[model samples]
Target: MSDSPHSTDGDTSRATLARVAEQAAVSMSTVSKVLNGRPGVAAETRARVETLLSEVGYTRRGAVVPGAPLIEIVFSELDNEWAMELIRGAGATAKLNGMGLIVTQSGTRHAPDPEWIDEVISRQPFGIILVMSDLPPANKDRLRRLQIPFVLVDPSGNPAPDVPSVAAANWDGGLQATNHLIALGHRRIGVIAGPHDVMCARARVSGYRAALESAGLPVDDDLVQPGDFHIEGGLVGGTALLESRDRPTAVFATNDLQAIGVYQAARALNLRVPEDVSIVGFDDLQFSNFSSPPLTTVHNPLYEMAREAARILLDIRAGSPVGTGRRELGTSLVVRESSVGPA
Candidate 1:
């Protein structure tokens, strides 16, 4: 029943937990936990109560502010060019800000294991950035209950409605890639639609279809094949497209990796690039420049996207304004030697 020191600012009466609770619009138990700097309350909620106490010239009995004060970056795997680029961007931002970053791989693409989620909670990071995947609702709820902020970078599927995300303009990139081929006077264009379940893949396909319709061309079923955004899918899908009797003159693979595999398929069929068949790919990866005759592709800045995601996550932690739940960087088309008028 010890009353804290009195406030000399206008009112000389000591502050009471009841008054704090009433002013904060929270229960007595919540005020108690906040004053004790307990982990049960939300960050924003805790910030609000702390602000109110400071304004009223009231000091908590023994509370220092509670913040885990670490940033974490989670990924499915960290073994690819794109992944390396993402790490560079995020790491650079963290270094400049004098913040330490914790990197972890979930060891699975579809989702992180339950133990991983538990580990995240135990660490209690200030913010988290999930690359190439989104947390399940249950996992997200756990984070929410703990009041930890998180964002997704290039999630395989659409993020939760309230979740924050950063991504590239997959649809626009797709449209531009297709349009570039069409402008080259290639009427019969083929496309390798990426994995069926990937949101970006579906978007690219839609863009390809839209571009074809805009050019008054039909989207032929035989011309659109499935891809997995990897070499194997490209090799298999590309082979099927090239073997068709009514094969397209040009093909747009969902990504550069797949496009290179397509080149292997074409070479097996004795089809020389550009002279016999034109190709356009997405993701202007470093390897794209060295592919035979080079590659005409869309440049998706994965690094910049990662940097921005880190910046945005920090901004969220600071309680600043984020324009939208989702942010998408623009993409550009790099016309290289791999594309030309079809023979």
Candidate 2:
């Protein structure tokens, strides 16, 4: 008599689960709880079960429902046009794939809230799109155990090497902005940099420095002022640079909001834009074009980045071989009226 195929599959499933439980030193119920993402299992036991599951390539059976699949996109905050662009891009892709999108604002720029992972596991969405740089290792392991895929958009800092991410060409944007100013004969250039700790910020600043060096210009520490990717930081940094004894004729704000702040700073000091101080900003946001004298800026491709991230997540769901490395979109310089030959 031949063994039934159903019997063989059932036996194999049982054996695998039992082996996982034995190795984790937990009861079958405990293993089930960990697999289901229930609250009763002890943290340590849950971790052990998750690790063993990953090792054995055990995925929860039938976790994804047949209809009403969703793709969750989480953000640290959604106050600016930057977030809007990302949402538009990802939402459009999700719609085309016949999936609904769930947008959430939870935790900080670095990682999502602790409880967010449990909720996600329970929901069992098709995939996740996180606009954060760092994800906790435990959360990553849990997602892997359940076979839920995720991709990062514009990661805040340096994420793990294996995490899939999409971002703009910050270094090139910085270099382009600086080189554009240099081409206009502005030798003494000032840069209002973003937060020092952010990876994109660091890369942009480095590009600025590289441009100056390539032009045989000294990298003056005093000319590089700190910003917070906000208007206030630009206002403060721009004011200080403008008030210096040897102020730079051109200023590059790391972001559009800071550029607006720079505009304000120049106005308060009765300095005419371009005529008094040439300005360049990043992230060619919509409002940047409406600013007086129209802001010259770098196009950061936020929409494209988000679209690519959504595609990557979908590819993971389809079992396609999307690599773990970052997919960087290009950035270009959009010169309007803000930048000009230095007076």
Candidate 3:
């Protein structure tokens, strides 16, 4: 005999289906048949079950009930094209599996509110994906008690050893971007780095320093300007580097938005890209391709990473074993018109 559709996949035993069955005052098997569109049930009984299912917003594992649970996507902020790409990928995957994806913001805080967690527990979602944010330990425990699976997408900080996370190869990306600039005969290289608190940013900058060290060049603290990973941060950070008496011939903006900001700053100083200054960036956001001179960037594969994360959650929901560890996608340098040798 096949597994019963009435049975759920997780420890979430208090399913909406159970309540619907209790309210309809019918056998769970009868309700299951109606829910799955299986025949051989009385028309009156089926109608009752359908009505109760609607009233309760519940769907059994194989039920064709509407308003089924969604896969939640929690984002730190939805202010960038890269964030949209993550949504597009996860949404596509959820749709393919006959599920819908819902996006929620983390608000001004990097993590969502406790009330938000209460709401999520009430909804009893299939799973959740956290993008560029960390979950509080208490919330993590609550989710575990509720048997809700969650994965992190490019986690913003250092996650615990047991957390499941998907991300791009930040270290290699940083190494390769700086290596490309080095190959172009640009010795005075500067870096407009992101906040030190972010794990990816830290890894990228570390790779930059490693590359310079490997080439027998001294790592200069004066050449590294730390900023938030935004266009405005890039503008301020890039300006500071550019105004220095010993300004670098080539500079790397750790993220693409900052790269665009660097471009704006370059224009302000009457400097031409690939001529008076060279720039490289990371994340390869769609707009990078259409920028003034096109960006030389490290492709971070945000969409693919998000899609894989969704797949992992699906497997977990299906009671399949997904390893608990950081999963890293590869990154590579894409050369464009914005980078060249020192003038």
Write the residue-wise lDDT of candidate 2 on 1-343 in tens digits: 0132212245656677888899988888887677566788777888788778767755533233221277889999989889999999999899999878899899999889888987787666778889998689989877876677888896454656778999888999999999999999999999998886788988889899999999999999999999999999999999999989999999999899999999999999999998999999999999999999999999989888888988998788777899889878999999999999987
Error of 1 at 308 (Å): 1.5
lDDT per prediction?
A: 0.79, 0.85, 0.79
In order of appearance, the predictions have TM-scores of: 0.79, 0.87, 0.79
Put down candidate 3 lDDT per residue, 1-343, tens digits, no spaces: 1233333454343366677678888777876665444556665666676666655544444233112457898886887788899999899998998788989887532577655775665455678888854677766765654456889886454655565889888988999999999999989898988887788888889899999999989899999998798899889988988989999999989999899999988999988997988999999989999998999999988889889999998888777889788888899999999999888
The CA-based lDDT of model 3 is what? Answer: 0.79
Q: Which stretches in model 3 have alpha-carbon errors above 4 Å? A: 1-69, 155-157
Using lDDT as the measure, name the better of candidate 1 and candidate 2.
2
Error of 1 at 195 (Å): 1.1
Clashes per model (N, Cα, C within 3 A): 0, 1, 0
- For 198-246, candidate 1 gives per-residue lDDT tens digits of 8988888889999999999998989989999899888999999999999
Which pairs of residues collide in model 3?
none
How close to the true structure is residue 112 of candidate 2, measured as C-alpha lDDT?
A: 92
Model 3 lDDT-worst window of ten: 59-68
